[model samples]
Target: MPPPFPSRAEIEADQLEQLRALVTELFPANAFYTRKLEDCGVTFDVASLADFSRRFPFTTKAELVADQAAHPPFGSNLTYPLAAYTRFHQTSGTTGAPLRWLDTPESWAWLRELWTRVFTAAGVTAADRVCFAFSFGPFLGFWMAFESAQQLGCLCLPTGGMSSAARLRLLLDNGVTTLCCTPTYALRLGEVAREEGLDLGRSRVRRILVAGEPGGSLPAVRARIESLWPDARVRDHHGMTEVGPVTYECPAQPGVLHVMESGHYAEVIAPATGQPVSPGETGELVLTPLGRVASPVLRYRTGDLVRPAAVRAACVCGTHELALAGGILGRTDDMVIVRGVNVHPAAVEEILRAAGGVAEYQVTVTTRGPLAELALAIEPAADAGDATALARKIGGALETALGLRIPVHTVAAGSLPRFELKARRWHRAGK
Candidate 1:
């Protein structure tokens, strides 16, 4: 049997030991880190986590992209031979170019184990029938989740090529107990179910594990999902194709996410200055996976902004893992300055999700004028009568919350794009 959960001190010590082991194993074999560490004049025998953080250089997506370009295809980060790798995936490329990632059997198993912990935290059991509603492409999330659920002896159902309607039928027919999907997709599926006259609240689905987007943590979004499927509880999760599963929502706390300290070492720092933020302050989340030595990223900058829980001891979850108060707030680059007001997509989504009756929406950042401004185009649901009134209500909510008057327009039904994975509703249209 596995050991009990370690305390914070034990977790830190384990992290330090793993850090040393990874460094010892990487140097002289991994060309990427050999050059980086040598250039920084650092050695493997680091004393403490603080020293390691101070001495070790950060790895960024830009650096990884350039490295791949310089070295061609796989890059020089691989410690093992190419033949040993069993998995290949890529980033969503929502911000910039997509990043290709690879994993060997060992590394892949490590990620699967992390997902197991995520499932355990969310109270998923072997008796639960889990259905993954996603396109089983190069994206690593659902693939890991699907495989992990299988390993847990769950009746894993994959709805890859099926349409939204077909997937809903399968879900209801099979009495799927757990649903794994993005929050946006969850809302979309609920909308589709409503249109089809299918009552999901009567279905056996009791838990929803949402990731690949920040919508799960937003109170309005979570409430909206729960309202749509009255019997289901939405649980937020955060991770990346590069870093593996980082955090899972605390079962006791609705909005808080506990870090998976068993496989990750996390830090929150100011995105601009690269300095550590206060306990309760918001900052970019930096991650270092303890396992994944085959394609390791030491002190990798994740670009995700989060606020750490003010008091870890206050948590009723019993584990001492660091908790993120509201999960991931938004990406660092997702913030926009519209007429002197700093607005984030998450904040806008919060208001929009809270103001029900809207089907889908898109935001266009207009830079043709003297300053940047936001224009919202919303697609009203069939039940949302009087498009003009819905638009006015959403506009008032946005104005009250953001302190900026963003123009809201109603577009034709089914005009805006729907997302199955990560939602990309914000568009920059203009030079």
Candidate 2:
């Protein structure tokens, strides 16, 4: 159950108090934020969340990347001395060069506190074996999940660099009940299980928590994953390397995720105007993690599109937590205009997935003179016959669904690249 707060005003008052303390401490200790905040004439003593958000100046990935380059290795985001920093991780660098993140002992422990809340929300217990199928690299993903599972006293099983078949064997042999991996990797594991003649639905696994991508939120993708492991429940978790675990799906509500307000402030703004959007309206998500002072993000533009709920809206789970009704609508920069029709890759995915007969697909946009050309490389499902026929069927469905006729071609199964983490399905042919 959520903390029984009287009203949204109380949440803001508490958050503002916390934010004031954080800024007051950060402005003097953290060079990166100090310079940014001081240059903007933002005082450490803030009166309200509105004043802070409006005056603090938005941080961007580009600025962070440049700072790391100028500072060498780790940037000056640290609020404490170098000796106080113990844990080191980095962003995935999917957008550009990776941003190195250093966490102090206090901040690392802070991450554990957060993951514990989310882990409990996902219904994880000490007796449940949380087998992480992640690569467990320095990307700040599975490392946090693994360490936090230890804090929870759950058996943290690492399956890094192990084949899907081996992972399946390990999970079954150990009677693992909880599984964590990317949504693409989960589906890939299911594919491998089917090819190896294994039954995952009968396995002891009962809950699947997928992050690093938006697949778990897609209706077709979620349905497929749940069908693969019929006894298991699939839920989506949204987090960032720069920002620790921030939002998670409500177990009672399947499509939306409630923003855990314990240590973060979330807002939605129109992408073009940079103005706050009304409740139920779609806009980009901006977050400010009140803790994580060692490497804080102040009103960082997340680039994720969302439809934020009403301030007093409470999910069916009986928690009056803020929720994004549609987990992540799409990326602000991911929209591609084809023949003057704006198309979001996620919406395209929905159409193709619902059409059926596709195991995997990749999207590529090429520059054709003055306009963008969209092309799809589709891999047919195992049970489907005549790959060309499947592609044609999906193409027709997509044209009808997206209201545009784009090219769709069939690719041989096992030919396209497979992803273990966040899948890079969309790519621009030319820079």
Give the winner by lDDT.
Answer: 1
Residues 1-431, model 1: lDDT tens digits:
65466777888999988888888899888899999989988987779999988989889989998898898898899988899998999888887778889999999999999998888888899999999999999999978999999999999999999999999999999989999999999999999998889978678999999999899999999998898887899988889988999999998899899888888888899999999999999999999998999999998999899999887663687788999989999888889888888898999999998898888999999886667889999999888899999999999999899889989999999899999989989998886
Candidate 1 to native Cα RMSD, angstroms: 1.5
Candidate 2 stretches with Cα past 4 Å from truth are 1-7
TM-score, candidate 2, is: 0.96
Global CA lDDT computed for model 2: 0.84
- Over 1-431, each residue of candidate 2 has an lDDT whose tens digit, in order, gives 85654356676777888788788888688899889878877777787888876777788788888898888888877788889888888888788787889988888888778878778888998998989998778978788889888898999899998989999989988999999999888889888999999888669988899888777788888888887887998888788888788788887888788777777888789978888999889899888888888888888888988888865555677776688886887889889988888898778877876787778889999976778988999999898799888888988998898788778999888888888988889989865
Which consecutive 10 residues in model 1 have the weakest lDDT in total?
Answer: 1-10
C-alpha lDDT of all candidate models, in order? 0.90, 0.84
Q: Tell me the spans in candidate 1 whose CA falls farther than 4 Å from its real position.
A: 1-4, 368-370
